[model samples]
Target: MPFIEDFNNNHPTFIKNLLKKSPGLTQREVLLCMYLKFNYSNREICELMNISNSTVDSYRHRARKKMKLKRTDSIFSYLNQL
Candidate 1:
């Protein structure tokens, strides 16, 4: 399955680390992380998640912050741990 393929290729350590750092993120924030890391845009995320554009944006920001990722940092740095 595509999900399995994606999961296998990407390490979960980054997400795990982020989750450990920020335990207050809602389910929506967690889902946003999965979608974003998998290369989904906010619009696509909204459609797939059945949520609003604003909600996706908000969740993305919250997820990144919850993960302790600096705003000035590139998203690629987060993937390096994999």
Candidate 2:
């Protein structure tokens, strides 16, 4: 996917470390995390991914769980740290 290529090109190290840290994450989840890292809102992600708002929420929740994030943790912060 173009978005994947773009992200990979722009943030190669972050992507590598993220995959190493959470190997179980699906491609979609990784993509979601990238978007969150860039501070994309749910509605923006929905439009960009051609998915519904609820689907975006689900992806966020699942990605958070896979990343072992606490409930109070910010996904943006977690991704940025990675």
Candidate 3:
């Protein structure tokens, strides 16, 4: 997978768009997305966020819904906007 080496910090801006469109994602969820979009592997995300793997999964699910990111295949799309 080569770790999807390209990185971007345009997360908050993209999330801002999501917030505008959905008007439902909470500030906590947004922060979680920003974390995932930036750094933290799944395990680390869970540990740092004091949540379980499934909770992280739930965050991802909700994030995709809020952002209208229909497919995980295109995840880097958010990063590219940086």
Candidate 4:
């Protein structure tokens, strides 16, 4: 996964540290959140993860819920702040 390599290239331990703190997020959700943090679109994420569009949306929804974000807040925006 080149994007995973890209993510690691930039953030290093950020994702790893976050995963340690976020017990509610599953592995897929954590990876989705990391991709979202990097400002990748859902379509791109779907392609990278080899999942469907709806599946990407579902992961985003679940990740946002786990993070307790408001519906109006952008998940990527919130993630970037962290």
After the best TM-score superposition of candidate 2, give how far the Cα of residue 41 lies from its true spot, in angstroms. 0.9
Sort the predicted structures by lDDT, highest score first: 2, 4, 1, 3
lDDT for each residue of candidate 1 in 1-82, tens digit (9 for 90 to 100): 4753576466546556656767887867766666666787878878888989988777777667766788897554564443
**Against the true structure, what is each candidate's TM-score?**
0.66, 0.89, 0.64, 0.81
Which candidate wins on TM-score?
2
Clashing residue pairs, backbone N/CA/C < 3 A, model 2: none
Q: Over the full model, what C-alpha lDDT does candidate 1 score relative to the true structure?
A: 0.68
- Encode model 2's per-residue lDDT on 5-80: one tens digit a residue: 8988888898789989889898888888888888989999999989999999999888888888999988888898
Clash pairs of candidate 3?
A: none
Listed per model in order, the count of residue pairs whose N, CA or C atoms clash below 3 Å is 0, 0, 0, 0
Per-residue lDDT for 37-82 in model 3, tens only? 6666889878777889998889878867776776745544663453
Against the reference, the lDDT scores of all candidates come to 0.68, 0.87, 0.63, 0.81
**Which portions of model 4 miss their true places by more than 4 Å?**
none
Residue-level lDDT tens digits of model 4 in 1-82: 7877888889887676666656689989989888778778888989888999999989888887887889898776666766
Better of 1 and 3 by lDDT: 1
User: What is residue 82's positional error in candidate 4, in angstroms?
Assistant: 1.7
Model 1, 68: alpha-carbon shift in Å? 3.2
